[model samples]
Target: MTQREKAKQPIEADVVVVGGGPAGINAAIAAGRLGARTVLIERYGFVGGMSTAALVYPWMTFHTVEGKQVIGGIADELVRRLQAIGASPGHVRDTVGFVNTITPYHPEVYKTLAVDMLHEAGVKLIAHSFVDSVAMEGDRIAAVRLTSKSGRLEVRGKVFVDTSGDADLAYLSGAPTLQGRDEDGRTQPMTMKFRMRGVDLAKVKQYMLDNPDEFYRKTPIDELESLPLSGVMGFFKQWNAAQLPINRDQVLFFTGPEPDEVLVNTTRVQGLDGTDVEDLTEAEHLGRKQAQQVADFMIRELPGFERASLSQVGAQIGIRETRRIVGRYTLEAADVVEGRRFDDVIARSGYPIDIHDPSGKGVAASWVKGDGAYDIPYRCLLPQRVNNLLVGGRCISTSHEALATTRLTPSCMATGQAAGAAAALAAEQGLAPGELDVRLLQEALRAEGALLV
Candidate 1:
């Protein structure tokens, strides 16, 4: 018939995962390896969503403040794989003192590894496809409508997972969702991360030594000479003196897989809605302008960047907050700070509540209690009113304060692995994802080396 009619024909799979970021990749791989015919759909030509597209380098805090490795499974697998290929140096101490460890990986290499692992697990990837709508059968999602270079198409699956970061699939399916903070509907500010090459680590370290009070309070001055400069989060004096137009309080940069290269994560685009195209466009423009100014300031003022040159700006702005599905259980600020444990724990994280003010000023942070991590319950992934749909990544149910920590990349991968295993198990049992036995799901994740205590 016509193109519209042709789009109605469905492509079948046991599990359908939307978004090809870290969460989606792990979800699809977990499902595929468990014998499900899994399909992964992404809007970009490559995977590694924020990692590659937004240039959010250095996966942070896979361990607790006590140096205990809390995040594992696919997240750990990805790091090990990168290390095997010499694309990453594995987990290193966080000199910035924001977290316990930061896993630095080559973003280009991550794209390749993600693709290779997905293929090895028998996952079918549909890149450059954006899902805009869904067909519902009662409370369950029957299919999702996708638009791409080839025009329109529909994907039908037994179970659906929304790892779209913004919970796009859940929103399209009419699931109840919450956006931004409770006081105001404003979300955390978006940032554009850029890279600089020819950075002199020795000079930067010496500067830190000479002006210890200018850096983060937790920065270990004595160890600077011995430890790698994995990350540095303070340049208070120079930043304040220069009076850059950017909204951030201090300079923050992370060392990389390359010795001479550093990723700058200091640009903050505040008071913008990440889901709105107009807001996103403005963020992109404003962020790039700030990036250029920041780079110039570094070259002129920062000791380590004397010869450094601006290398690359991210393909997209880094979105820290968006629409989170209102799931059966909403993770709260107390749960994170108190290190709450759940009987149905699927994932755990020790990252703190780090809220970059929506008004574009300072950050409010609170670490996990006494070097302990809090549990992420299975009910958090079960969106209310959606029968066969699951959610992973930063979009899973959580209060605005709690989102600051759960929005982290490593934790997103953990939740994703849980959702994928649950999806495959539910599909095989001919049941909705919520009806799947939490114990069995936990067992499956543990079998795959996931850490859920």
Candidate 2:
């Protein structure tokens, strides 16, 4: 390779998506299915970002307040296909609540399914590649420089979608972003999810119904000190204000094909900045150590976990909060509480305003009752000054309060699909994403099986 050849070579595509998780995968697939040459770049080798790589099983809130399926398109198809292959467990139709309408999948199985979906859609996948910087031409993004084992390279696109969850590309492109809340600007805590094997599922359930207190008292985990997992069990009651009642026998375990396995979602690593590489690196090490300790405590202290062993740890530490792009409109907490609707609403979310304490040990979630659900305006996904850039996933424009509700995977997928579709239309019409016709974009989204109301 000569000196001229060593210069960052540019690879062009119609749409270039950053991040290969649910949001990125759906975005790339949607764009490709729409006849756009899409290139998806991921830091890891897998396709499903959080769901697969982070081992975050069981996507939350895929339905509406009226018990109707709200998240459709590629999101619905991905779940259905995984279920057919025994990768995901079948959902209990209209179960106890809206959150229960969707099913949880095995993380490993989900990874396989996501890769298959991308392949079928003809999306060019470049895994193990990290997007380092954005190349701008005037007001629009011209290309993005990525670094991998093969060295530095550039991927140029007409329209760019920031699905990195951290909003790396968007921020590097000089887009204004809000991290966490305004008062102190503290990001939510990070978690390291792990799975345990040899759990006695029946005993776990019995313990929750029988001796909830005894379970909390015996478990050494800090989150179970007062408010524990048991508090989240009541059918209609909200566990937001009160402390979660601890599940002595791990009653909240996900029931997958492996009877002995139990997924643990409890490692709360706090005070670490997701944007800081040093902080993130420390958080990962600390999270893994804590996960092992929790696993050991399960076997030693908990009744049903006497023989339980650590099965697997999450590939990436689960980052709860990060950058919130300052878009044309920012969804506020008041909007969420009032269930505000917008004329240009692209999707709706009913999940509670769950603000995980910066302490990372416990959550400060507030539930909305009655018909309390908010519409996510299309503007929140579009940056104010940027012309061709769109943001999806956890980094969308929202107030500190509203970001919590919109951070979930299902909602992220919804925003990602819409953003991708909008980007494709903008490129095909030779217009900026912000200048694209809203009504036409909405119609296209609906036609592509997206649930937009």
Candidate 3:
């Protein structure tokens, strides 16, 4: 049979989401709650993209620098559910230094919660499915071509949300897109997150308190010494004489649900574009190897981890950026640093511009002055030259600098929720996503408990 002849019966929905990460999860939930027939497709067998697949623990802070909760709605609901099940411990502030917003959780627990929550919201979840192509009827996406174990199949929808993180659907639909910075077409490094078990929390905490100089913290705030493992930023110098193969500085670890468990964020594979199949494959190998090297160094050099075991590796490497769709509006660095507000704002984010060096040499973080949050306009979600489609997650339109902050988990979820609701409403009104009344969309998001600036 020909490629077209092998096609199966179309799976129809009012809204179709092409990802199962934080953004895709919330998008489907929001769409389904509006009484729209929603379907969520994922590349993996399970949900929770970076969080579960990459073993990335904790949601980045949902608050502004002023300590006000800026990101709520579906994002907050997920955290609350995880906390209720002891999968997460809510949010913690790193007063020792940059006031990092951290909410630690279990990867498995996060995956479970996401799947259950999507099901409870009445969103159909299709796992291990990938969108290979798009069928465009004029400017609108008539159907999405997916290749899975069952072979070629198509999903038809009134509206489509591209939360693929890499803008897969948007790009496949011939939408204009850009990758990395304008300088070299290079993107941020990919990381492999791992966990350490049997960690001696008491011993580690005591050592951190005693050898505060070994670690770096700007101000000594409340609960300083109690933090099991804060930022010991300069521990990397110790590894220099020993000559570890790992790139970058510092051994960053966050406390897990149990005192004896901790999540480690230290592996980085630089100069790899996440969208390229060959590059992504190479990153997965190199990232995991780096993780093993880091783990061995930990047992040999660090305290509290003397008896710790390299318990688990992530399901996949954590991707920071890839193909960013060129949307109606491109958010600039000034928008983030100056805390610019938009008339059709969808979400608020306070994360600094954290750039992981493409050379695998180092990292640079520039904070937002006054610790304020900036707005993501509704236009950013509307991919340019596309009808009945929206882009969410890290793939949204933004300058490289602004993308550093807007791509956070909470920020992605916020955008996902907004895009989903807007798509559903667009379908209900029988209008294209680009033609729908944005003010009404904002009202719908506000009703869904999202905090729009």
Cα-based lDDT for every prediction: 0.94, 0.76, 0.84
Taking all chains together, each candidate's TM-score versus the true structure is: 0.98, 0.88, 0.95
Query: In model 2, where do residues sit more than 4 Å from their true spots?
Result: 1-9, 93-98, 212-253, 369-372
lDDT of 2: 0.76
- Candidate closer to the true structure by lDDT (higher is better), 1 or 3: 1
Q: How do the residues 330-426 of candidate 2 rate in per-residue lDDT, one tens digit apiece?
A: 9998888777888887777777787878753445666555565678899998986778899888899998888988999988998999888888888
Which tens-of-lDDT digit does each residue in 1-453 have in candidate 1?
876677667889999999999999999999999999999999999998998999988898789987899999988999999999999999999998878789999999999999999999999999999999999999999999899877888999999999999999999999999999999899999999999999998889888989999999999888888998888989898999999888889999999768999999999998889999999999999999999999999999999899999999999999999999999999999999999999999999989899999996799999889558999999999999989999999999999999999999999999999999999999999999988999999999999999986
For residues 1-453, could you state the per-residue lDDT of candidate 3 as single tens digits?
A: 665665677989999999999999999999999989999999899988887888766678788766778899999988888889888768777533554567777777788888887888899987878898899988889999888877888899999999999999999999999998889988888889988898887776666666666665553434666554533344544556667666776777777767788778888888888988998899999998999998988888887889999999998999998999999999999888888888989888878787888776677777776548888999999998888899889899999878888888999999999999999999999998888888998898889789986
Kindly indicate the candidate among 1 and 2 with the higher TM-score. 1
Clashes (backbone N, CA, C under 3 Å), per candidate, total 0, 6, 0
Number of clashes found in candidate 1: 0
* Sliding window of 10 residues with minimal summed lDDT for model 2: 230-239
lDDT of 1 at 375: 95
